[model samples]
Target: MSNSNYVLVLFYSRHGSIAEMAKFIARGVNKVTKMDVKIRQVPDVSDTTTIASPAVPDEGAPYCTLEELANCSALAMGSPSYFGSMAAPLKHFIDQTSTLWLTGRLIDKPACGFTSASTMHGGQEQCLHSMMTPLLHHGMVWVGLPYKNKALISTTSGGTPYGASHLANSTNDTTLTEDEKALCEAQGQRIAEMALKLQ
Candidate 1:
């Protein structure tokens, strides 16, 4: 990984909702002066024990490398809700970070998480927390949105202190509510600021 100042916006999106949220979050990260953004995604996991995906994704952001994860100044991770937790693909990608953990490559870096779910009660916060656990174990600082954002108090769709979130509804909607968008942007900006301070 190049020694550059950037926040890694990493995620897995099966239905495009989390992908859209990643872009909005990237926009927020871009707002931080002098900080760049690196957006990456992980390929799907296959149960057949064959090559589940190509070495490179056909489109969208490139797959994340262990070096990129270890070298990033900060991270904004996301996933579509899977049974009140992060999807397996993202978890699998994170599971590979054991090497980083052994070396303390991610120690003290700032990290945060986000999620999107099919229902208002579809465990958005739980998914966010699930994603945070590994980062916490890696010794990264966890950043969270505060209620001062105002949107967190009024969002009927998705917004939380744990992190940014979206209620995609039953059809896997990609559109975010105004509050959700603000929260996503806020999450990006907050992580960027935290990274700068931690640097």
Candidate 2:
């Protein structure tokens, strides 16, 4: 049951910003020798309460399997902000993980979170924290951007000491700065390193 080569970068992207961040994080995971990255996405929730998203997503990362979560060496989660919290679909997806919680499947694993918002102050931090709650219940060791990441002190776009984030705009801009990308990679590398050592 021991995995020495993988980390799961799981996320939900409504308008594509958060998905982009997840890729950057995965790229960082690939920077380490013998490390592997699995990108997983959650299915979109339907507006009709009685209906459900298809079992498979049409594009982007495949829907996450609970087994993937249980077996991954570490987790990097993301979501777009929905008024100071993660979007409903991502939250709903995480809510379905009770089996993992009961078995402590993710216990002691290194975890980090990321988010994107429509404005500069559109509750990015709150969304990151909201996403972390479930991981906390699973006994994850939380990781955040450290001062040593370089981007923490010089970023103008979407880097944060709390976690990596992107400023998706009210004007519909979705570009990530170099700093944001660097921070995302740094977070990934940091968690991957911790997971490998802890194992």
Could you estimate the TM-score for every candidate?
A: 0.96, 0.93
| Cα lDDT tens digits for candidate 2, 1-199 | 3345689999988888888899899988877776789999988778753227787887888899889899999999999888899888878878889999888899999899999987888999999899888899999989898998888889877877778989876525667888888999998888889888877
Considering every candidate listed, which one attains the maximal lDDT?
1
Candidate 2 Cα outliers beyond 4 Å, as residue runs? 1-4, 47-51
Q: For candidate 1, what's the RMSD? A: 1.9
lDDT for each of the candidates?
0.91, 0.86
Clash pairs detected, candidate 2: none
Q: Quick one: how many clashes does candidate 2 have?
A: 0
Residue 2 C-alpha lDDT in model 2:
30
lDDT of 1 at 56: 100
| lDDT of each residue in 101-192, candidate 1, tens digit only | 99999999999999999888899989989999989999999999999999999989998899999998765689999999999999999999
Native-to-model Cα distance after best TM-score fit, residue 146 in candidate 1, in Å: 0.6
Question: Looking at model 1, which ten-residue stretch has the lowest summed lDDT?
Answer: 44-53
Off by over 4 Å in 1: 1-3, 48-51
